[model samples]
Target: MTMAWGRSAAVGVGAGAAGVVAMTLVEKLEQRITGRPDSYVPARTLERLLGLAHARGRRAWLHNLAMHASQGAMLGALRGVMAGAGLRGPWASLMFFAVRLTNDQTFENASGVGAPPWTWPRDELVVDLAHKAVYAFATGVVADALAVRWGPGPGQVHAEEFPGRRRHIGPPPRA
Candidate 1:
């Protein structure tokens, strides 16, 4: 029932990368339909974080790609850990969606590279949420599949023991 941290994180990285690919495709399609310009906030944020000079053209695009890929891989680790802990399926992905949003907003705002989501136009917000949702669900799918080899997680075992009871729930019994 113990969580396999190393393996989980590795799998999560791969899952996250897959998620980024999926999200990118969704964004491209959406952009083509909506005629939305690419947002360079990610690249700007990376430049700020690294104290690098401002980049334009190909450099900015590269920065954007790097940020997206690295961020996805890193965050996917959390999703992987969740799967390893038996928090799989759509519910887990839903939870991860919130986490992903929070992480982005926190860094973007703190870095002064982006504004808060509440300040964004409704359409923009919707697009952002949709894209992130794609990433979360895709990542979750991969993490869940990879973690299945470990069998049910401790949380799953605990749930089976307690069923629908809500009150006076205690720690799961020792293995």
Candidate 2:
């Protein structure tokens, strides 16, 4: 039987949390090397949602932290469900990368805190992609690990017509 969504989501939380942590560490390390200034998208989105103005000091840092972590955890749940359905490996990570990027852009654009991606400077774009890639692949690794307990998910099951995984079409094609 297929895994239930509830269970998938639960495992996803764990996976997502692990992914976020990894992503955070990577970002911190990269920041030291590249001397890149922090992007304010997460903090801006939080402020918009909370109906608060741009903040500074401990308050802004807290908001930024909360937004980053929460977003990662929630997105991880989505990736978890995907893995539960048999979407794993690089293919799944690619899809998840798109999802994560889209999620962030949607929030930023909708909140009017950011402009379209095409409008971003090349350097900013690269930095964003680098960070998101870490999160996407990290989430995929964790989700795949958790879902492995249940075996190849529902989609991996071969259809009836593909029985025994026969490779020769119509009795071997006489080659």
Candidate 3:
């Protein structure tokens, strides 16, 4: 049940891919209801970062998706590491929410394709938050589940080491 960093990272990327799929579905549903146009930040950010000219059609959407999906997968690896450290469940997800938001804003602002989040329209901000939360929670579910194989993380170990802490509920704790 010991944490394996390589395994955790690989599992995390898988979980993140799943999270991206879930987020896409949720976004599609919301778009249907709100008639919101697709956000172009991902594509724009990629284009700028790569020094590519703005794409006008399918290529633009393709760049957007590549950035979006790759970002989700990469971020998932970090979440996996968190799980390996015994950070799971809602609290872990909340921590991950901040990470995800920071990652997005950093890229967007750096690319000069987006304004500071505080300057965004309230509705736009809310929508972004909603999507990011979905990604975070979904990633948490998968990461946590995968981490179950590795047993409790470092945090869990520390907590369990408290005097009089419950033990012998199962096999020896790895964390």
lDDT of 3 by residue, 1-175 (tens): 3567888888889889989998999999999999999988899999999999998689999998999999999999999988888899999999999999999999889889988999989999999999999999999999999898878886787777674657555544454
Estimate TM-scores for all models: 0.97, 0.88, 0.90
RMSD per model, one decimal: 1.0, 5.7, 4.4
RMSD of 1: 1.0
Which residue segments of model 1 deviate by more than 4 Å? none
Give the C-alpha miss distance for residue 152 in model 1, angstroms.
Answer: 0.4
Off by over 4 Å in 3: 163-175
Model 2: residues >4 Å from true position, as ranges?
A: 159-175
Clashing pairs in 1: none
Model 3 lDDT, full chain set: 0.90
CA lDDT for candidate 1: 0.93
Model 1, 1-175: lDDT tens per residue?
A: 5778899999999999999999999999999999999999999999998999999999999999999899999999999999999999999999999999999988899889989999999999999999999999999999999998999887887898888969989987567
Model 1 compared with the native: what TM-score? 0.97
Q: Which is the better candidate, 1 or 3, if ranked by TM-score? A: 1
Q: Write the per-residue lDDT of candidate 2 for residues 36-58, one digit (tens) a residue.
A: 87766799899998899899978
